[model samples]
Target chain A: MSEKYCIGADVGGTTIKLAVISTEGEIVKKWEIPTDTSERGKHITRDINITIDNTLEELNLHKSSILGIGAGAPGFVDSSTGYINEAINIGWKHFDFGVELKQLTGLNVWVDNDANLAALGENWLGAGRGVKNLIAVTLGTGVGGGIIANGEILNGANGTAGEIGHVTVKTTGGAPCNCGRSGCLETETSATAIVRKAKEAIVKEPHSALSSIKEITAKDVFVTAKQGDIAAQQILSDVTETLGLALANLTVAVNPNKIVLGGGVSQAGDQLLQPLKDAYSKHCLPRAAEACVFELAELGNDAGVIGGASLVKQYSNEQ
Target chain B: MSEKYCIGADVGGTTIKLAVISTEGEIVKKWEIPTDTSERGKHITRDINITIDNTLEELNLHKSSILGIGAGAPGFVDSSTGYINEAINIGWKHFDFGVELKQLTGLNVWVDNDANLAALGENWLGAGRGVKNLIAVTLGTGVGGGIIANGEILNGANGTAGEIGHVTVKTTGGAPCNCGRSGCLETETSATAIVRKAKEAIVKEPHSALSSIKEITAKDVFVTAKQGDIAAQQILSDVTETLGLALANLTVAVNPNKIVLGGGVSQAGDQLLQPLKDAYSKHCLPRAAEACVFELAELGNDAGVIGGASLVKQYSNEQ
Candidate 1:
């Protein structure tokens, strides 16, 4: 039997990342293509198909040597059918991207939410390697999460199983959220939320170092905190305290082997992790706290594509 | 080959309920035996073994006719090995109950936490039948929970995946929980918590209907609320509002098809269900709220044993 390869594509508003991964979990080649949002992303799947054909031809790989396609999209995706119910960023609504790609390339396809794919990728090759249970949280523009339980991603009853961002952290008098909820984990802990907290903290500490900057980022907060700015340290404390409690509560529910922290805010690294761990240890069940470990996500920008490839492998095995 | 049967035992602090169930999910005969907690429950498994042997002889059924035994015990049980790490109620610090039972009876044995067993039973034949994802909550003296995701019981890293009771709700300045955490869902919605709320409400409403009764119970609060007692209604509202929010948060994480309400407090039925649904609908993500439903558990006290039988059946299929 010839060596089998699988294609993984991560579709985003800016660009689509594609990777050719071997069955042994090595990325043979990887590249990116611009995403066409015109006409409701109709050309998106076609463009992906064209790129795969061109790439295979260039590499001298036959269709039989490729396993399948695994795609990750932003939206409420039906994992089994790769149907996008709604992806606001790319303007896809009720689109069958997976089936179209499969037909175009003559291979099986699996699709999942981008956040879920990132979790799968991290679990397979990053911080969660060798562990069957993991929870991956992405602290980017918005807080997103993926839960891997008993070695499978949990998509819940409505394909929203890992909606960790919406987990209500504040019971009352919380800031309003985009989801029309109040006091969500996203409201207090996302990178955007950290900037919002910094803006608010500056109002109280007008003479602080952060007040001098016209615009502040989460990274700036970490740098300023390291320089002994009280306002920045307070924001870090508040965010990690809230995030720590929420993650602890979540840990008790799913009991993952490790929690992989990724995205923009996690770049702060140990500055964010130490306080969060302290809060988690204080709040989490002693048994679960002792058993579970926390680590930074290692795959970075490649996690989604890698996870997509893994999806194809997992589905192929099931078949 | 003659039809084979399995034994299911629900071990409690006071009694052990045993049942003979056919592989087709029918309970043929059921009975109970007093649990011997003397000597740190050392003789409990032996007593159960002797009883099983006597029951088989009395019914003229041979050992070969039985497939295996499935048992449910209180506390932190390692499901795969059936090792009782620490069952505080049964006085079992560290015991291999499953191995002892299997050695004594010459049959395979499977053991799991009792709350988890109830969830399995309910999902297998009760409210969650035909649903692959389910959450079962027990509102007894204390709160207990079990999660079934993708048709398998989720025993996370250290066997505590469904500790829904400990999900932090109050967040700060709330009542302390037995788990050394303050403001847990269990601190607000357990049967004991309901009575505590009722007592506190009666003090404020001195002329209310609940003040006339001594030693108030959770059932009393339900009955009085139905009879238009303002104080009782207030207690119901407070408890359910907290429970509704907690369950709504939990639903977002696991996304179960059905949330089964079991244990003593659930006997309040519609009085509890209507308010909980209203609050859940208010707090849950609209898509998830529409996809999930709440139901009162059907198995009641029999849920544990029935779930144990299901465990044996499930383990048998895996083998």
Candidate 2:
């Protein structure tokens, strides 16, 4: 018999990444397609189905061999029902994502928050592999988080569990966040926030290495800090300290075995992890800190799609 | 076969509250025994067993009529193993509670953090009854938190899943907590903290009604505040605001449907809940705040023992 397969779709603002994974959790084929936001992302499900059909045919596989599809979207997703309350980045709102995708693909489809899928993907084969309790933090334009407790995604009431970005880090005099709160963890640790802090620092230290860059990025700040620029080092310290404190507090609450750092800012690697660990140790309940380890996400951009596959494989096996 | 019953023991610093609960969730008998902390609490298990034996014989019940024992302990208890790493209040450290109790009673045993059990108890029959996702916060000598996700206790990797007391509310210049951290939620929101704040306020407002008292307690602060004492009112506002913010941050991470307020400090009822709810709504992510409600814990001191019974009933059904 041909090996059973599943499709994983990661719907993003600009593009949608899809993968065909074997039942054994290996990616057999992977590709991407442009996300058409016209008409409020209504075409997204149909487009994904078309691409899956084309990809399956290209692999010379029959539709019967496919187990199901798992989708991850950037929005408040009621994963139990595959309904997305809103995906502002994709211009979609109150859409029945899972049902529409299932109708188009003629297979069972599971949907989850993109960050949650990334955490699951990482747990399946990435940094948090085999760990029942984990916290996944993605440091991109904004900080995103997904928590896995007892080996399942913590989809709280209304499915907003693991909204770590919005956790207030600063009780007073904190920078404002897009979530209508001030001093969220995201405000101090997101890539954008890091760059903003660096830009502000450069204005004060015009002779610093960061001042030479046309537009200072979070990466540039890391590189400059590595070169021993005091200003850049201070910025790095501030971001990591804030992040570490937040993660430490979160650890006290969830007590995860591992914390996987992902996305663009985490690419700074140990530059971000070392100081962050120091601050976390200083702030965390010692026992929790000792039991939890920090690791950089191994899957990179494929985490969401891989997590999607994990979602499909998990639910498919249950049936 | 006779109706099965389970023993629930809430091991506190001074007393061990035990109950015989039917498999169907009814309390058949309830009582308490002073905790003998001699020999570093080693006598606790034996004492609990002897009382259970006495109770069963008095009720003319056979051993076959019993299911198992569920115990709740203070401090860092590894729920999965029933090992009390340290219950400082009770003089216990590195004690294998579950195994010892099981050996003595010859019945299955489960153990968890006292706060977590209170949450289970609340979810089972109190304010959070039937709520699959809930957060139970006990405001007492110290703050205690328990999170229930999808109807199960969220015992994290090391059993600190609901250590909401350690969650940092003041990131800087905050009072120190016993857990070797500064600005922990416990530092600002505990019963002790309330009394401490009230004492400090009364120092300046010596003409206030609170100044007339020989000793001030958390309850006194609430009552005085209700009677329009400026010093007490300020103290209540400060404590509730800090508590509300910590709870709001916790809610962002767990997103429980109901937040149950328990312990002695919560006895203030609306005086605590109203201002706390207002502060929570002001700080929590709007959607999460909108979805969640605050309720007073109904079982009072009985919550922990009731929660223990719930634990036995849950695991018995699973088997």
Candidate 3:
């Protein structure tokens, strides 16, 4: 009762990371729950509601003690209306999840693309904490991006404002991307892309360390590349070159002061950052290259949940 | 007095257009004066001040009669400090032009990129009026872009927020751009690029209409393409495809509600627009494509001066 708190939920396919955060962005309490994606994720809102209720009861807090709720979901979301688009496996589209969550929890609700939330989270409390204009890139199974310009999300006409993954990196004779485009940054630089590129390279370098691994992963490529495996190093070099070019292209387009690289691939750290910085400098305009700084995302697993809370906190403050 | 007015100046290499704009977004009067590139364009500010004072006195108004002065100049700018960067042609980098003008004229001053002002002008009084978010592109000798989101300029760090022209369209083996990058959108879609592409294609088609003309131009390419000239049609198709892909990439990155195309090349009209739109739809994500619209920039040649005035007007209103 002495302090205000907002609830945040980061929804993924396997689990939902939830948090109760203070107004100042410190997480007061946090937990995770298995995602009940049954019935096309219809049970998601109800589940969140029950979790919130049970958590508050466990803490001896009342519903009125909470401010609002914000969520990050892995789908195209119309944040203005909280409409989540697509659930291919479940045959669902446009859940209008914000309204459902609001109805169940009796609180103001905001929902946006998961990566966008991560971007907001990073800008507010992570690697890009002080920078008002920044770009957050998630090098996950698929490449994802969130752009923040002048302290607000550049959510464009639709909610797909920061779809940096799909920006064409290779115009011709490029690999196809899941986004119906070929040569997208996602196709060349994502964790999946790294694994795929390494697998292809192993055909030519049968004696390389990567070829000996039955299940080659992005981590395997990075680990071997760092240990002086020429084939794996070549694959990573190719990946970073593509990403650096894409980042350079993005820097020109958005001109963010900071670009925070996160998600799985970023874990390779210096192995990825050094080459990426080199490629970016080679590709970027002189003025932009001099001004923009590149770094890795810091908030780790908490980015999404904290970003969810930050969204709600910011929204509440605005209201 | 019963009415308020503001001064706007749009500076170019050849000429400087000035305007007296009423608070209601109407231009009361406008005129142009030659630019003095002497002293690396340092005398340009004194020239603007002298002109403003002369114009104010001629109109029987005092300097205080106007609210402030807003200006548009070419190259990267720190709008906050009014610092214009780079002047290869004129040696005019980092001129605190606004402060000098503000001091000389004894009024508030604002300055931004010329293309950005053009976008603001178009958004305020031209095609994108009432649309809070849009991307304005000037397809001049080089393509230039200005992005407006939620009614504010997205002037990213160092003021290079929307460099849409330089976005990479061809990942490998494309034309080189002035920005020192290869396969940039500017390389494929700018007026200079169009002519370059045509001249290169003419080697294979000696009997084409383009070959008949000693100096092949963008307009010639469009006209001949309209007349079923194979070489010209191919050139136009290539230009549109590249431009459409660039625009599509921009849409995915920023999700602007409207994309306003202006400048010399856009004068090709529907011959360019129809194909450009088709390619845009082909390249854009379906959801984003559905929400976004394309329109020609209205206000024409006057966009610069008016955009300058709009910036001051908006600034004054904010105050």
Candidate 4:
């Protein structure tokens, strides 16, 4: 008898990553496919189906050996009903992705918010391993967060428990956010926000080295700041400061055992971590601040796929 | 054998309320005693000891039949350790209220924040009885909150999980708070803030009826506003608006089944609830806003004692 494996799929705007993992969380096979989110919601489902079929064939895994499929997508998901209420980036509104996938592949499917999957992934096998209470933050295009408490995802009544990106960070409203709110934490600390602020700084200080770059990203700002570019350094400092303040507020509210930092901007490593820690310490209530440990995410980009697989396994075991 | 009952003690700065409740959550007996919080920390122990003795005698119950005692106080409490860490209101730091009480009465004692106790009380026997996930807001001199999830109180890593009073409601700093932070949610939406705003409004509108009063309380402002005083009404509106916005942000994060309002100012009832619901609907994500139900707290003053009793029963059962 062949070993049973579960398929985990992470669907994003530009690509989808899929992985096949055994019951013990070991990856047996993995692959990726281009995501056609340009055509709205139609192509995403089609793309996922084709990718799954190809991966199973390559792995020579029979349908009987495949336990189930798990998918993590960006947006508000009704995990209980397997429905996506809205994904502004993907232009999907109330799409029943789970039902559609189940129909196309004849497999049981479990779906949830991508950030939440990443948090679970980290908790099960990555940085948050051995910790029952944790919060994972992804400082990507937008600030995303996932919370795990008492060994379970903190999915609030509407499955929006870990929407840390939308929490208010600035007491006075600053720039507007994509979520139709102003002064959201994402407006100041996300990778996109960091770049936006850097651009503004370069425009104001044309003599700086950062102004010479064709286009500046969060990475560019961090690299230049490290080499002593005063303007870029200031931008990096401000971003971390804002992030720290938000984390401090989060510490008081969630009181997690650990906070894992992931996403593209977190790749800057210590350049970001040290400053963020200082800010968190300065702002958090003394005891909670001391109790929380901040660390870099170990799963990196694979967190979504691993988390998706874990979700499927968890769902099946419960049933 | 006679059914066992839990004892609840609410230790406030000026008063203490005690109640004996059956396991089924019925209040079998209750009483009140004056608390000399002004006499430093020692008087608190004396007051509690005297109250418990008198109450047990009055109810004709022996100490052997009492299950345990749960205490609620204003401070940072290590619920597991039963230690009160720095309660500025009572001018005590690192006070072992639980150990002392247990030694004096020869009964187990549990201690937690007063607001959290009220929330637990409501969850067990009041407005939030059937809801597993909810947030209880106490709008008094200070804004305090308690979160109940999955039929248990959410005491985060350092036991500070439900401090919604400190959640940032204003993106731009509002007013200075006693917590050493500016623009905290409590600074803008607390009963004290409402009264301060009312006084400011009276200054701006010299002819307003509220201006005639030398000193103003949240209740006084509500009454004058109910009589159609423009300044008082405007201040009250601002208070509700801030509260609604705060609730909207909190709903996004907690996705609670309901938000129960308590404390002194909550007595305003519909005058506060209507506008708060409207503002919350306008500001919250549509799905989260629709899922949350807002209501006035049902436990009233008994919430403290009842919640305290519930805590003891629940904790002991878990152990």
TM-scores of chain A, one for each prediction: 0.97, 0.97, 0.96, 0.94
The first chain of model 3 has a TM-score of: 0.96
Which scores greater on TM-score, model 1 or model 3? 1
Model 2 lDDT tens row, B233-313: 998898889889888888888888999999999888998999999989888888788889999999999999999999999
Better by DockQ, candidate 4 or 1: 1
Per-residue alpha-carbon lDDT of model 4 for B29-84, expressed as tens digits? 88888877675767787778877888888888898888899998887888888888
- The collision pairs in model 1 are none
The local distance difference test score of model 2 is 0.90
* C-alpha lDDT score of every prediction, in listed order: 0.89, 0.90, 0.85, 0.84
Task: Please list all clashing residue pairs in model 4, or write none if there are none.
Answer: A170-B171, A171-B170, A171-B171, A171-B172, A172-B171, A172-B172, A172-B173, A173-B172
What share of the reference contacts survives in each candidate? 0.71, 0.68, 0.69, 0.52
TM-score of each: 0.98, 0.97, 0.95, 0.86
Winner by lDDT: 2
What is the C-alpha DockQ of each candidate?
A: 0.76, 0.73, 0.65, 0.44
User: Candidate 3 regions off by >4 Å?
Assistant: A87-92, A171-176, B60-62, B170-177, B180-183
Error of 4 at B106 (Å): 5.2
Per-residue CA lDDT of candidate 4, range A1-319, in tens?
A: 6688888899887778899999888999877887777767687887788888887888788878888888989999988777998887777888999999989998889999999999988987899886777989999999898887666777788778788888765546577888776777788888888888888988899888888787778888898888899998888878887788777776766678999999999999998999999977776666677789988999988999999998888788887
**Model 3 chain A poorest 10 in a row by lDDT:** A85-94
Give me the runs in candidate 4 sitting further than 4 Å from their true place. Answer: A1-7, A21-25, A34-70, A88-92, A99-109, A168-176, A199-205, A226-234, A312-319, B1-4, B36-67, B90-92, B99-108, B168-176, B198-208, B226-234
Predicted structure 1: clash tally: 0
